[model samples]
Target: MLVQMFDLLATRRDFFVGLLLEHVQISLVSIAIAIVVGGIAGILISEFQRAAKPTLAVVNFLYTIPSISMLGFLIPFSGVGDATAVIALTIYALLPMVRATHTGITNVDPSILEAARGMGGTRMQTLLRVRLPLALPVIMSGIRNMVVMTIALAGIASFIGAGGLGVAIYRGITTNNAAMTMAGSLLIAVLALVVDFVLGFVEKRMGMRSKAAKRTNRRLAVGALVACGVAAACAVVPGMVAGAPATINVATKPMTEQYIMGNMLKDLIEQDTNLKVKVTQGVGSGTSNIEPAMESGDFDLYPEYTGTGWAMVLKKGGTYSEDEFGQLKAGYRKKGLGWVGMYGFGNTYGIAVRSDVAKRYGIKTYSDLAKVTDRLKLGAEADFFERADGYDALCKAYGMRFGSTMQLDIGLKYDALEQGSVDALIIFTTDGKLSHANATVLKDDKGFFPSYECGNVVRTKVLEQHPELRAVLKKLDGTITESDMARMNYQVEEKGEDPEDVAREYLRAKGLLK
Candidate 1:
């Protein structure tokens, strides 16, 4: 697994390098911002004893909000990118820094403070020279805690389309590529360790009272500041490396199949044109998030489902005509978006059961499973429980209720089923694990599912800005069949191939690329 992970890293060196720098950039910026805000807040609260409790309470409350939820709340104002990521991480880094600053300052000995004052020191001098230096160790400890936490939480930033190492981790999970996941995780762990060790060493050295030690600490602080400046430059430089090239940003929902499609489109566009294609994969909140970003011009294109665009985006329910494509295009036109073309796959949601359970219950269709639902336990992703076309509506459509339901991570659903923790699951039509787990997909016999034909959807303004984009994207129209998509997903999830590699091979095999 380690060898495979290294091999994967070597093959995608440029991409991984960008992600690494991005991760560092997000962490550093967030920590710097937190230090400024948290450090000041800590000082004020420490000095004003009456205000300490309530102020600390507010900071604590902010920290207690779930990471993803906090990020979601920030997206409306910040959109999807490094700014949003930095803001969210900065908030998360605050509590530790604030607490540490307050603790360190308050713990200073009273006699030492009085001595500084008696020596003609003003209140400010007493704080800067006496209390602050004495409190240096504790304050440094808080900064250390904030730095480590920020690095780890920066991974979650990728979910909101802020480029970072988390992109690799989430992609690995969606595709069931253990090597990819491991590679990302290991790198993040190493980064956190390095940051902690370096800061910790500095903190210890600063705690020494010797005059020579103070000189050494000042030199180290200068060196650290320089290092931070360089890191900030590295984080922002890569985004501009291509030098004003006509760029198209692609967005993708958080799933294996979406990864394959998004990368495929990115590869095709980059291979054929001078235009730079920046793909932001595994965007959370699905279409709800992606659509708004498009409207705000944050993304140029993404693979969107017809059913999602129709029912969810257009708010037109109970659909279908053979002419659905025309209707979808017309609807999106009003929103400054265009349906580029279909990729020739219909990836609707499905109810699936373990083969043994399928056989025992004679469950071959959704309705058949409904009869035995009271005896079955369902496991699905958290998103499935909340989607408009998700669990609640599905149950209503089939008139079925499971004995119990478990909301498992998308990557773990198959494991849950195989382990008999869940008798059935919500599954994507193209998930590779369906075969690995020996599961049988139940037919949606009553057509409870709307048509979910996959296609490229781009912002119309982006197409107008770069006329060749429409031509570049034409290469993918009707290229991948339904089975082809499933096989591509299988190769990633079950065979542990990278999605980019899988997409490249499929395009070559189809003679779309040499």
Candidate 2:
């Protein structure tokens, strides 16, 4: 484990540093936001004795809501990424700081406050000199608490594509890699400890030094003004640039069949047509990313599963046939989206076991696996834990429970399964490892998983303006099959080949490109 840690640190130094940086950035921003908002809230609560109890109760209640759910609630407004994470962390950081601020400011010696007022200090002057100075040590304690809470919450924020050390931790937990998990946890712990220690020292020194107080206040005032000015400028500038290169933006989840298809389409369209293309990888699983990006006009085109589109994007509540093209077309139309074209293959979900394990257990079908369920171990992606038709449904259907199980991210499932750490895994049928490692996918006799046909879910406007994109993509629609997709995924994911080069080579070999 030590060797693995050193190796990961050496090889992934940049990634670890980036994670640590994001960790600090999120924590600092959250603490700052909390201090501003919570301090004001504390002040308001302090002024009115009658309102104090209710206000504290509300802020305290907010602290009880799970951080991940809070993030999900903010997803619609903020969308995914750093903005959502920062906002969530700020809210989480508010409770402790608010309580501490209210306690600190209100608890200042009433006699001192009276003396300041008698000395001709105005209300603001009294606040700045007597109340604030006396409250500094306690407020610093609150700030310290906020910092720790924000650091912890930062990891959960990675679920919404907010990159941080949490990504590594989530990947480790899902993939069942103890080394990676410990690495992420250790790094976060170290960061939090270092920050807390440094801040504590600063607080102790500030308590002793009367001369440093005024200078610190001046610096803070200037910093706040500069930040406000920068924010005002950013608000005036539009998020999207006009007359920029006309490009199609594709969003997709990591290590899925749709991700591969999205990459392929980007290459095909850019090479064959006079259009620019960019792909945002790992946007989140299912239709989590599709609707928001399309509605916000952040993305132009991306691949989505037929069933996911039918249920999530369309808001239709029922299952559809595997080859229900008409239903899919109608659904997309109703949702104000366009289906550019469909891939020939359906990336179905299946339970895969190592070939040796399959033989040992006589597990040929989904039912067969149930016989030896008590002796086997199962692994699934992180999202699978909450998915409607995922682990919960699969286990219920099979009437089986395992001796040990782990929730892994989709990206790391293959590696964990291949290493024999997990006996059975929830995997996509088109996963590269099914063929690469000779894994056996048990037959689902009950047909639990619906067909996940790969296709471009393009914004209606993009399709109308660039009708040629539809035609370009349609040319290669049925050319790639399940096996072909698996191989291509392996080429990029396993063999370390660039996805764009893999797509180009596939297109060239198929005579689709000159």
lDDT of 1 at 341: 69
Weakest lDDT window of 10 consecutive positions for candidate 1: 316-325
Instruction: Enumerate clash totals for all models, in the order shown.
Output: 0, 2
User: Per-residue lDDT of 137-244 in model 2, one digit per residue for the tens?
Assistant: 888998897887678778876677676788677655433346666888888888888889978867765666566775885676688689867855664465356755
- Tens-place lDDT digits, model 1, residues 127-158: 88888888888888888878988998889988
lDDT of 2: 0.75
Error of 2 at 456 (Å): 1.3
How close is every model to the real structure, measured as TM-score?
Answer: 0.94, 0.75
Extract clashing residue pairs from model 1. none
Q: What is candidate 1's local distance difference test score?
A: 0.85
Best by lDDT: 1
Best-performing candidate as measured by TM-score: 1
Root-mean-square deviation per candidate? 2.2, 5.1
